[model samples]
Target: MPPASLPSPSRPWPIPKLHLRIDDLHHEGVDIFLNVVNPKEALHEAIMASFQWLYTPETVPRTVLQILLVLRPMDGVAYTTGTQSHKEIHFSLDHIKRSVKRARDEIMGVLVHEVVHCYQYNALDTCPGGLVEGIADFVRLHQGYTPPHWKPTGGGKWDTGYERTAYFLDWIESRYGDGTIKELNEWMKDNQYHRRIFKELTGRPVRKLWKMYCSSLGDPITDGFVLVSKLIVKSYKPLYPPTWKGPDPGFL
Candidate 1:
């Protein structure tokens, strides 16, 4: 007889009801996704990553009750949307197909990014969009899901977003000590976002922090331009080409 299924391990944070919706069963990406991961396990791990990286047991948000994963043909890699109690992660099968060489890692990375949105605070809808995205990618980076293409360099504004802003936040956490990002996120939960928060957290203004970060990377800005050896336009490459507009409106 086959072995019995093992019991699920206990989780400190709430595990929302997980669901999956495949828009096209016949899509080639569907086969690839299935071959690579167990949906339940993958989603669970993504949630745990957000909790571990972004929140402590006492501070983890308990608002999310359900998370639905929708796989379909889409323009970009993925975007998330839903009410406070529920979230839907719409992942692109087309993107998955293109990432066949690294489907599992890419899928997990995207999932972790989207899942962070479900739990992250938004400064009462007043936080800069770039900072919001940076936090998501920050958690993804901590979870060890960084794509091979991602590199840590500093040049542009501190809130440039994605891996750029993520690396900046990572630097803050390293320099200021752990839980710095957690405190930053917590402050956003009940107050409006102000540049002063950085000062409050690390005894320095955000601009000063950005300058130090750039200097550490040996890519300080000069005359309002990032003085680097070469500028690498960061993108998901073939999946999110240069022509791609930007994040979906519903992505927040």
Candidate 2:
């Protein structure tokens, strides 16, 4: 279940119509996907994850009316596309086959990531591609579906996307408070992307936040002087690791 602050199943948020298209029924990945997950249930959980992490009942967008999941032989893991009212997620069956060892979790993670794209704001189509992808992965990270290879290490730019920026956003959420990222998302709904929004939310610039995040991770990106002496030889434990309260009843 989501925290008491978030909407519960009884007070369900709106869910778009979900449609699945399997382009190759005989593909081994198709069988793997079906055996590993119930499509309807998994899709429901993915949608709920977006709502739980990125929106409130009153604030959630209603523009997306349908989401079509297309499982086909593709080169990449997955990607999303569609009109304002409908979205299509193209998931790679080849990737599914490769992820057989953790099929259920991987499929759910990708679904959640792509579902986020269906509903997330994009700063009037001006948001940085990195931040856009970062927010999607941010929700995935919070949902506890993170891949084994993901880590919180920080050295590159903050908006490097994927788990890197997701971890940075997670750090911000921990440092500021819950709803910080939700507010960030809401800010992007009408405005163009700007570094100032980070300041508005946390009273610090995004670059500064990035530096602190890197320092916390023992990444030597601090400006000349070491930010944390303890991190010189050892990793500094994060003050607040992002929390995952597990799934609600019937969530999976």
Candidate 3:
């Protein structure tokens, strides 16, 4: 389920020419694909998911004039890349076949993630690769397409990529305010990336925020940074600490 507070596509973004190229019509994955969704609608949905979550029409890039989805038999998953005016998405039929039980969700999820890459600012290609992937998954997560097997857990750095970074971003968005990620993305529009962007947005540096995030779940941090204990998930109940006992006052 998507968090209730996700932003919407209140205005129209530039609608690119959406096209699909199915490399194998006889593939088993094609059978499931045709059974589940209309290709045009699926592609359009992914586009809308990208615009709605990451931008308002005013901030959206109008340079993307077309998106071509190429579905072929390949290993692993999908990827997207192209010039400023045209984008190409290469989706794997093999991956779709493997995720057969949840084909519709998985395909749309991958499409959403890829489409995000086509439109998202890359800090002129200097942005951390993990943040790039995380922004993609963040759009996927907000689209209500997160797989059932996905879990929210901390493991490497804040920019660990994929769902790890997506969850961390969602937590930050929930903690500081809505559209926190939106502002972060906008800052990357015309300039190269710097770690200071996080501090500018949240009044704390990225490292400090990540440490506070780690410490929230009873993890100890060796790096003594200025900590803010006020930002809790509020969903995890404690056995003691009477002051912490309550239904989420923030959510209420």
Query: Which residues of candidate 3, in runs, are more than 4 Å off?
Result: 1-11, 221-252
Model 2 agreement with the true structure over 1-252: per-residue lDDT tens digits: 756773355545889898999999999999999999999999999999999899988888878899999999988789899999999999999999999999999999999999999999999987877788889999999998988888787764676578877888888898789999999999999998888999999998886777677767766564445443323332334322122222221100
Q: Which portions of model 1 miss their true places by more than 4 Å?
A: 1-11, 223-252
Native-to-model Cα distance after best TM-score fit, residue 154 in candidate 2, in Å? 1.3
lDDT of 3 by residue, 1-252 (tens): 867885655666788998889999988888888789898999899998988888888899999999999988987688887899999999888888988999999989999999999999988877877788888988898888888866556434677678767877887787888899999888899889888899999998887677666656545444435333434534421111001121221210
How do the residues 22-98 of candidate 1 rate in per-residue lDDT, one tens digit apiece? 99999999999999999999999999998888887778899999999999998888989999999999999999999
TM-score of each: 0.85, 0.86, 0.84
Which numbered prediction scores highest in TM-score against the true structure?
2
Candidate 2 residue pairs in clash (backbone atoms < 3 Å): 1-247, 1-248
Clashes of each: 0, 2, 0
Worst 10 residues of 3 by lDDT: 237-246
Positional deviation of 132 in candidate 1, in angstroms? 0.5
lDDT of 2: 0.83
Model 1 clashes, total count: 0
